[model samples]
Target: MKIAVVGCTHAGTAAVKNMAELYPEAKITVYERNDNVSFLSCGIALYVGGVVKDANGLFYSSPSELQEMGVNMKMKHEVTNIDTEGKKIAVRNLETNEEFEDTFDKLVMTTGSWPIIPNLEGIDLNNVVLCKNYQHANHIIEKAKQAKKIAVIGAGYIGAELVEAFEVYGKEVTFIDSADRILNKYLDPEFTNLMETEFENRGVKLALNQAVTKFVGREGSVEKVVTTEGEYEADLVILC
Candidate 1:
């Protein structure tokens, strides 16, 4: 039997490893758009806050590890098209810009989620970034180091955590969200209220119940965040 797995994140890595062990006789090929696999994205805040001393520690699995399990690990390979009926897929080698096709008896897709970016003015300006994967973590850490005033445009788990991290790192952080409270979707008002108080005590500015209307920049770099309630000065903006 031949199997093809698209994506090599947590789920993809788990599926590939389990299948490789359960069906030793089967041939498996894993396609990953990124060069690395199985990154612990939840720890991104810790990493950005200097809690995680090594960036390499974020990755739980690697291509070489998967390859050792008798599985073909195709790093930097994207599955451009999948023909389910024909059991074939068109692939592109990102490094070489080469395209090719491969046949598989079975297919598994574990393509993960991406951050939702709003269509706000000046969003594409420098220092406006999204937090989702390994690359974003590194970018945030790098940008946070140079930014005096940092603004995060989401109050979810990641956004709240990032704001706290930035606050501990001595950066002036402004936490913004459309909802009335931080982590409204994940936590109850009681919990969020306490968290809000804690954050406020640490001098982290909370801009809840305000929707971001636009981002203001000077000379192609972000300078301010304009929200429904008010505008705040920001040297770096992170859209969680």
Candidate 2:
């Protein structure tokens, strides 16, 4: 039997490794656009803040590791289009700009959610980044070294934790969100108030009820974070 997996991230990697072990006689082909596989995106902020000593810890698997289990892992191959009716697919090799078609007896799609880019002005700024992967962790840490003031949008778990991490690195952080209170979705108002007060006391600005309308930048790098409340000078911006 032959099986084809569409992705190699968290869910996909887990599925492939389990299937390969359970069905040793089967031929497995895994397609991943990234050169590496099985990376823990959740630890990106910790890695950025130096809590994670080694960046290699972010990845749990590699193409060579999967290959050792008798799996054919193809890196830098993007599954551009799928024809489920025909059990065929169109793949593009990002490095060579080459395209081809392949057929499989069984197919699995583990395509993950992408970061929701807000329809705000100046989103194309250079210093603005999304903390979603290992590469992003490295770049965010490098950016923080030179940033005097940083602004993080969204007060979700990742956003809140990042604010605390960036603060430890001596970067002034302002967290902006449109909710009436911080972490309104998670904890009770009392707990949220306590956490919010602590964040504020730590010098991390909490701008609740304020929605960012635009990102002001000069020379393609973010300079100010503009919201309905007002504008705050920012040397770096992080979107979780």
lDDT of each: 0.93, 0.87
Q: Which segments of candidate 1 are over 4 A away from where they belong?
A: none
> What would the TM-scores of all predictions be?
0.98, 0.96
* Tens-digit lDDT track of model 2 for 151-205: 9888877788889888888888999898978777888998999999898899998
Candidate 1 residue lDDT tens string, 1-240: 999999989999999999999999999999999978999988999999889999898988889998999999999999999999999999999999999999999999999888888888998999999998998998888888789999998898889889889898899989999999998889899898999999999999999898999999989999999998999999999999
Model 2: pairs clashing at backbone N, Cα or C within 3 Å: none
TM-score of 2: 0.96
Candidate 2 residues lying further than 4 Å off, grouped into runs, are none
RMSD to the native, candidate 1?
0.9
| Best-matching candidate per lDDT | 1
